[model samples]
Target: MAIVLGLRVLGIDFDDEERIERIESAFPAVSFVRLNGWTIAELHLECFPEKAFHEATDLIHQLGAYGELEFVEVVPHLVNTSDIAKLTGVTRQAVNKWVTHPDLGFPAETDFVGGGHARQKIWSLYTVNEWLSEVMGIDLGLELPPMNLVKQVDGYLALEGDPLLDGAKDFHASGL
Candidate 1:
């Protein structure tokens, strides 16, 4: 099974599997608190129980009354339209419009001068990476450009599909 742990948030994301050898390799007596939605069924939790051997039938109801001790998974933030687009070799117009849309995701930020002209638009790097991995199937890494530097262009920067746009359009909409 695949387990994604959030060290900072004290949470874990787990996928069911036949057996978790990694946990046994590290923790001999590790306990899996089976949580299906809000209810916790203590009966379903066996000490290092074989993944396939564990009873998954009615897991939510079988958990019984251990709601207070369950380890819940926290949701991670997502990368901005432009950042995700740049990382995925796509355009901001596509990222902002065709991809994440208005009600989802966030914007990028940099520590350089003249940044954050607005405050509510900043994004955490991990959140952005998490979103990319979940939505655009792009892995977030630290290999992005340092910011404030984009592809150079010439003449009036129209909002249409100019094909000559530097790169900021990755943040803005296309055909604006």
Candidate 2:
């Protein structure tokens, strides 16, 4: 089975038409979206879990050849009440009620955006899915990608550019 991973790439110029074409040509399978100005590219890829780290590293390295590779991370999906409602085909009021009812054991918001009246609560998609399955007894009829594997891949990738960890050997053997 293939797992989908989201990658956040920073310090790359998306305005250069030639560079964009080259990147798209080289990474045909990756879906890239420019977000928060021209410097960040959000890339989505579907690949075997075992190959995620290597594939992400190679892609980042290739992108680095074009510009500075400041940071790269495997980001998880975040959603709000409206997103939950849309995803589960329910009303936003229902989601809000679930959140407000303490007996429902709904997961707390992972983040908050804006302030006061405009504030919106955010939850990890995985967290919400688990709540739906275990608490609400609802199955969305789809398996979420293995988040543990994704997190491990993210951790391994984080060690890639750390100078202090240079020449590190056999992370698994070391029981890291």
Candidate 3:
């Protein structure tokens, strides 16, 4: 069991190959790649039998603590605007307006899909929670479920591995 961490560092220049090389050297075991035009580096580290999931997760947290990472939140799952509205005890329309309002400090949706007539937006739950507590001065009082529940569901509902990891592996294997 392994956990994949996605880090967003704001200061780095993603287009500079030399800077990327330096980052790769700093983390030889982990895979790092630019995230489009976001100026963020996505790191993927998969451990074998040597490191347990919890240990790996801890190390990843430590890296964030020691590095220049601007945002380091564990992305558990994606939630829609309606879900956020329900959690915050507000209407979906209110949530939509909040997303567009820059003063609310709401995290931007991770994705936007559909054609001109139809559009959908989605956000990472972790980010939403962080913004709620840190920016909005609101806490939904979220707490982890019982260990029994976690063990039962275990891998059944975990987020899929980061695609950058898969693409990195392929690129390395092909000597690209």
Ranking by lDDT: 2, 3, 1
Q: Report the poorest 10 consecutive residues by lDDT, candidate 2.
A: 36-45
lDDT of 3: 0.55
Highest lDDT against the true fold, candidate = 2
Q: Local error of candidate 2 at 79, Å?
A: 0.8
lDDT of 1 at 151: 12
TM-score result, candidate 2: 0.76
- Decoy 3 TM-score against native: 0.40
Over 127-173, each residue of candidate 2 has an lDDT whose tens digit, in order, gives 89999999998887765557865676566557655867655624721
The number of residue pairs in model 3 that clash at the backbone is 0
State the lDDT of candidate 3 residue by residue for 1-176, as single tens digits.
Answer: 34344444555566767766766677664445554345444434354423433443444445445554444333235678888988999899988887889778778789976768777888877688888889777798764322232232232112213444544533332323
lDDT values of the candidates?
A: 0.35, 0.69, 0.55
What is the Å distance of residue 83 in model 2 from its true position?
Answer: 1.0
Q: List clashing residue pairs in candidate 2.
A: none
Estimate the lDDT of model 2: 0.69
* Regions more than 4 Å wrong, model 2: 35-47, 65-67, 141-144, 167-175
lDDT per residue, candidate 1, 1-176, as tens digits? 32221211112333433233343333332334433232211222232323311222123212222221232222222345565667778877776564336565543443332356643233556556656677667775553321111111111113222555646453442212
